[model samples]
Target: MTYPVDLIIVGGGPAGIEAALAASHKGFRFILVEAGEIGASIRRWGHVRMFSPWEHNTSPLGRKTLAVHGHPVPDLAAVPTGAEYLEHYLHPIAQSPELAPSIRTGTRVIAVGRAGIGKSDLIGDPRRADHPFQVTLARAGSSDPVSVVEAPILIDASGVYDQPSPFTEVAVAQECEASVDHYIPDVASQRGRYAGKHTVIVGGGFSAATALRDLLPIAAEVAGTRISWILRNADRKPLTAVRDDVLPERARLVEEINRIATSADVPGLTILRGTRIRSLVQLPIEGGSTDGSGFELSLAGDHAGTLTADHVLALTGYRPDTALLAECQVHLCYASDGLMKLSAALLGAMGDDSAADCMAVPAAGIETLRSPEPNLFVIGNKSYGRFSHYLLRSGIEQVETVFDALPAPVRTAK
Candidate 1:
């Protein structure tokens, strides 16, 4: 059956935008949908500067596309904050003639599946590709009537930032989630909330490190300000510094944060290693009301005990949301929740000593981008699932790989 378009791309971030550009270049009819504005997730952490320079953050196709439209190129050596990257690169690409016409913002893809078949019907049969994919769409975050669109191919580039991992291995407490800051907080602007307050920070990744780095000066400047850092691992240095790191900014951040974790000399800073939050209760403030004024936490592990704080920073990273593809037969890794073949490739590289650094990860081949269901691809950070090492460069490469493998458009371009 003929579909409305040759392909449907879900997401409007770097990967999705790049895919749309590729689709246009390949002379295919395609639609790119974004749940929010382009680069919405990036805008959330816009204040933080990226470790990778502009060279690695953008795609060659994207740059070429923008250049052809007379858009100025960014300095390749310059590292951009999330805001700058969004404004200068992603936003422009989305608005470029190549992609703008096919893009839809504030439209969420609620579900996707073969139009006439259930997940079990095809069972590895080549006949499966004959059916068009039915994508359910609706206004983002609303319960209005849904619209279904059909496409022969679907590429899910939707990223993971919208879904943050809970602070513990088990389910998160509703009270804890409602009270803590999940995303990296803009400490400078939110000084009124963080200043002179005791904060307990959770997690061991770069997000956590960034929060710690940002809050240190605030703690020093504000009288009675205190910070208690909680790491799930017992390592003295929570962040691993790449040997002879290629990204100087990332290396410096690791070194600085690790130094703070090891030195124990920074006043108003307390590092609690190998700790977890067992329970958290909002305590009543001076007037005997639980208005989010304070928290009493029951801790577990190496530094197990009761602790009190005015704020909690749970920068524990994120995982991909796979619910939208529930009706499709996609193979996901048991551990990472990443596409199976790609996850195996990533895991294999991670096991090797030489591939210790994220930069050393092996490039994803076209085969790794394919799923059990034919003509469906999961690219970008979502393809990495819970893996935290996805570089923007990798997503660009994935877009190229997937498009290259797809068949040329059967009908005239829209």
Candidate 2:
């Protein structure tokens, strides 16, 4: 007899954990498989602080569940760093008695599909609905499969942190692999490397702003320090809007960046707006020193000029890793944010379809989260696909909406 579980959650982040908690409360058997510890992705940016206060970050279900278990909730008004959010809230919820048994950390989900059915199976096939999902999972350290899980419902809350957007605007033949740095490195620790170097920071997102902030102190201390800020938009600075803002931290973030840019005391700062990196050519250093050469970037568009820098910080943002979903055969909107119907609703609900703008769209309930693959659902940042703006609260709300739509006596034994 196969092990039976009502739902199989493919992640253990805020969305996955919250979904697991809701499933338990609804009296359903579920299992949550995570490739790492709870809040694994959040831990990557432990140095960064979140915009939302504790209240907004914590879901009603998560907070209530934690509170009932004697977990001390942080002040609702307090904004937490990614580390604190993981350590204080996410960890507690994952370790809770209700969820701990169901969550399997250090396990990677390789593929997901319905048992005895291929992606080409016709919708008219009644067996598709009744068929249990076959989820293949592997141990983190090895490629070999440990076990296969069968469940009627599958909630894919896996996030999108691994795939950072490419640096070039168009395809280039140059081999400049060593010239790229996608993530924000702890500049303080490696101050010596960036001290006297000419660094070119790319992208117009919050990550680029944070990278700039990280390098400012180094610039002040080190002599001959030069930095170039490049972006596609020339009209406006990188900012989270202040007007009609629900989160003060977000507004403050924009304010901080603006203040840094305008400050007269901050020298060696150059802003190159409306620029596109057409190609990148690595220039070898005349004298081989510890500093590893530099990159010469070809530019185009409004700001057309070549720039050379010792380091290229490409904070172009991230995209969802939908490679695992290809086998499931779900229809994704190539132009919009989500699956066909979902993409339409998201675009329609929000007048503008920008990733950040779509975050403001009200939740369309659980029905919208479902995919064409019957019981399979996609939530969290992965659901947003190429879109950038995804909030912890929004994902938590999605979990609630999903559980709320659950049918009674859930999955029948096949």
Candidate 3:
């Protein structure tokens, strides 16, 4: 099946929802394709709370959209968990009558390219600009055909949650796969699985800190349980205590993690800094049997030692999934931070500690959002690529900029 539309928006998360709303307001018809439920990525990290409060997280436009549906405004200062952000704001905006019809959940976009032209032909084809985009879609789980949609514009808002950066890019022993948890589970609910187990948590970001802090209490309660925290940066310090932060919860979390790291007095907790995993080998379980039961890691760097664990939680980071956009021949930075044109801006912003925050990096404007492929742009977290600074507020601002910069609509003859 094929449907012609004015714009095709990929992803159904916060950015995609904002794009759909912007398109609707601009009088352009669009369809949003999502591989899973709306806010699926956030749902994965629902147990984690956001550092920014509701006011900073939501946009004026989103509020208006929700208001149209008779939804009441939430407390501006309340910082919501991932679940609350989805339920109280995003879900309602997505379900609003104006945006609901355009949303297609559980539909994954397989590929995107120019209609009637291949990637090789896009360079010299004079008709390429006039040609519509061919977007291939398939059912979430099934291989069966769903439909091919054609549109003049394509917005790639797909974020990075689907792609997890491996602990080591090198090939892993097949046996090590079974002991890893890519996504953090609700530790409280899954305490039994972790009780009395030796676990290693990798990475040094907020996620890593959260995992360590959450596990501290469990370690105290469960006998024989041990925790290993590994970080690549030897110079990295504990989370800063943000006493005057607008969001007190985030401030509290930061202080808690800071205390744990600075004191180094937590029982059953060990910190390994400036370490890298050289190799992972399965450990023998019991009498004459190796069923990939446990594992040991050969390490390098400052620690320069091996560690054994019953379970490994790698909270490293994520990167954008650009496989779907390959067919469209969109230009991405060699560093994979964002569009090639954005290198200077992103780099410049990074040099300034305060500006490193994606929200602090001034709105790149809709012009900055464009890729080599005309009318195709990437927004939201996906736009940041490997850069971890992107904020929800920045994504919302990008949506407004895109709408503001949209060209005037063409009228059809009667």
Superposed on all Cα atoms, the candidates' RMSDs to the truth, in angstroms, are 2.0, 3.2, 2.8
Clashes of each: 0, 0, 0
**What is candidate 2's TM-score against the reference?**
0.89
| Residue 363 alpha-carbon offset, candidate 3, angstroms | 1.3
Largest lDDT belongs to which candidate? 1
Runs in model 1 lying further than 4 Å from the true structure: 284-290, 352-355, 412-414
- The C-alpha lDDT values of all candidates are 0.87, 0.79, 0.81
Higher-scoring candidate on lDDT, 2 or 3: 3
What is the per-residue lDDT of model 2 for residues 1-414, given as tens digits with 9 covering 90 to 100?
Answer: 234788899988888888888888888888999998888888878878888899888987788877898988899999998889998899988898999999899999988878787888866354576778898999987778889999888889888876776778666443565447888777867888798999999887778888898898777778888899887877455554544667776767778888876665577788777788887777765564323468889889877878888999888877767777777757677863456666666767764523344446798776577776777889888887766667787888788887777784444565
What order do you get sorting by lDDT, best first? 1, 3, 2
TM-score for each of the candidates: 0.95, 0.89, 0.91
Question: lDDT per residue, candidate 3, 44-70, as tens digits?
Answer: 989888888899889888888878889
